[model samples]
Target: MLDAMLPVILLLILLYVGYTLVYKTDEPKKERKIHEDTQEVKEKHVEKPKKHVAKRKNPVETTAPKKQIQAEHPLLVHVLKGHTSAITACAFSPNGRFIATASTDRTVRLTLRESLKSKNPTFKTINLPYDYATACSFSSDGKTLGVVTADGCKVSLYSKFKTKPECITTFPVEHNVLSLLLNDIGEEWMTTLTIGKDDNTEIKCWNTSGHLLQTVNVNQIQNYHGVQSLDNRFIAVAAYTPEVKIFEIQRAKDGSFSKLNKAMGLQGHTSGVTDIAFDGSDFKPVNHIVTSSKDGSIRVWDINVRYKLQEDPKCIKQFQAPSGYYSTVDITPDGKWIAMTQGSALYFLKVATMQICCEIQNAQDDDITRIQFDATGIEIFVQGTTSRIIKVYHLPIE
Candidate 1:
């Protein structure tokens, strides 16, 4: 009886053990499957918000390019292209009807100002015989165009420049011309020439017939940069020195250039001056002059004082450049704005407030060589050392 009881109890215990093993193993698997499904649902919910957020950003990304276009529209007006090489110099006609550009391509192009926007703009190309043109200027009457060549150091005058351009005269220069200017009467011109191998400079006055009237030796001021006043009465020279000298173009009763008298010296800049510009208004004599220097300062000088009385010219205001040396500067014809270049950037400052009104970075492909305003002050012409294009920008400020 005891053995039979033992066998039954053992069978019951075996059955209970089999039930526990099978049920407990399947319960955890079901729990794990449910947890995995919950996690997958949570992941999908998280991705849905991410997709919604991305869709919400689509409009903002689409509008970004429009903002860039609006910012660029007001600054750039026209890009005059034709030269194959770097542009050396550019000048606007006195009447603002034409623009003359000299380039390393050994050609001078006179383009109609109004035709710049048209495809295949109307232009007159004057092929130079020598190397390249270094400087250019227009007579006050806007009837003649003067260009200086580098190889033979010659000055060529062009008459009927607007239509059928003709080289009227080509005269050999004594030295390399750094700057050239034609008098208001168009009968005479002046040039700043580099003398010898010493980097010294001199100013030479000449008649349109190829005769040198007088030579003013400015050897003391090495590396001379000069600009003529609108009235053609004075020349402001910057000589890689802190002081800028003003020379008066003394004329005889017959209206011929007699001599250049040193009128006064502007003493303010701590370093060498780089460029100079006059107000260029219709005033009889230019009273205000702007100078830029390596010291990173642009100075406005009041030259209306009595300099013969030993009075120094007063610096009415001075503004600092953003960085690097100021390569060139120009004041608008209306005297409302001053434009300057530092490296590849162009800055426009309001004359009345002395504040920067606009700044365009990387304005040129290379270092900017020159910056000038049109006769009406509505457009500005900019050129670089290596860029073949002449960029004409509209003044955005009033």
Candidate 2:
């Protein structure tokens, strides 16, 4: 009986040992691994949710929309880069469909104003007779363009319809031509010449046939620029002095240009006047003359009251210019604002209040030689001094 009892007890002990090793120890190890894995998964889920929530609460949502909006509305709309030398002058067609540019490379280039950024932009370049093309202007009828060389002797007129602009005509002058002007009907033109040692310069008006119509003598006018009013009844000249000379353009009863009469002088600028601009088309004369001066001031004058001022020409509004010489000034087609350039910067001023609306700092790589507004005044073209590039800027909507 003792021996049987001993065998049974031994078997029972072995079974217990086997049960503990196979079931209890292995089960606990498996459950521990599952628990550890579940805890790791839970921790991962918690961290992931926190990261997502933090991202949603932080700049991720705000900055994304802002970046998208900024991408959609770029300040710089287009860049034109065909010129091989420094650009001297730029003028937009009256219809606002094209822009003509003159360069020291002895080239006049026409670019479609609307398609400047297209894959194959439409541009026509004509080689000029002389280098250092100084200035250019478009006739208000959009049918012809006039370009001048630095010597002020050769003036080339081009017809827009021709492919090569077969040398429309050349007008000879005695002095270097500094500025050129064309009438709205494309019938008449005017040019300003460089001053000589005798402190004398000539402002000549010519008909379409290149016949000189009227010649007015101006004394000591330096860096002179001229523009005709929208009605073509007045021509305003600004130079390296505070006084701007106003001339009345006389027209015949049959609507032909006759001659120029010295009207008066606008005196306000303390230093040399760098640029001048008219408000709108000559058909609807605004009688508003905007001017920029080296005195770092931009002044607007009402020509309607130009003759009333006894002493200094009174400005309707005045504002300080950006840093550097106020090299150029242009008014929008709508006559609501003025665009001025000093050095590489472009400044926009509200016409009514003379408040600075916007400023594009260092808008170009070099000096801004010219500035122009399109027909709608929604875009601006800026030409640089030596870069030979035209930068198009879109006016920001209020």
Best by lDDT: 1
Per-residue CA lDDT of candidate 2, range 1-398, in tens? 99879989999999999998889768988999999999999987784543434334676656655444323226788887788888888887877778888888888888876676688778888786545678888776677788777755677778854465656777765666667777644444333222221234568777656677777876645646777665556677777668888777766776677667777777777898888887767456666778888898988877666464544345788888545568889887567889988788888888877887788887887888778787667888888878788888988657
- List per-prediction Cα lDDT, in the order shown: 0.80, 0.74
Off by over 4 Å in 1: 1-73, 186-198, 282-285
Q: Please, what are the lDDT tens digits per residue for candidate 1 over residues 80-106?
A: 898998898899887788999999988
Name the regions of candidate 2 deviating beyond 4 angstroms.
1-73, 129-132, 184-200, 306-313, 321-325
Alpha-carbon error at 73 in model 2, in Å?
Answer: 9.0
Worst 10 residues of 1 by lDDT: 189-198
Lowest summed lDDT window (length 10), candidate 2? 190-199
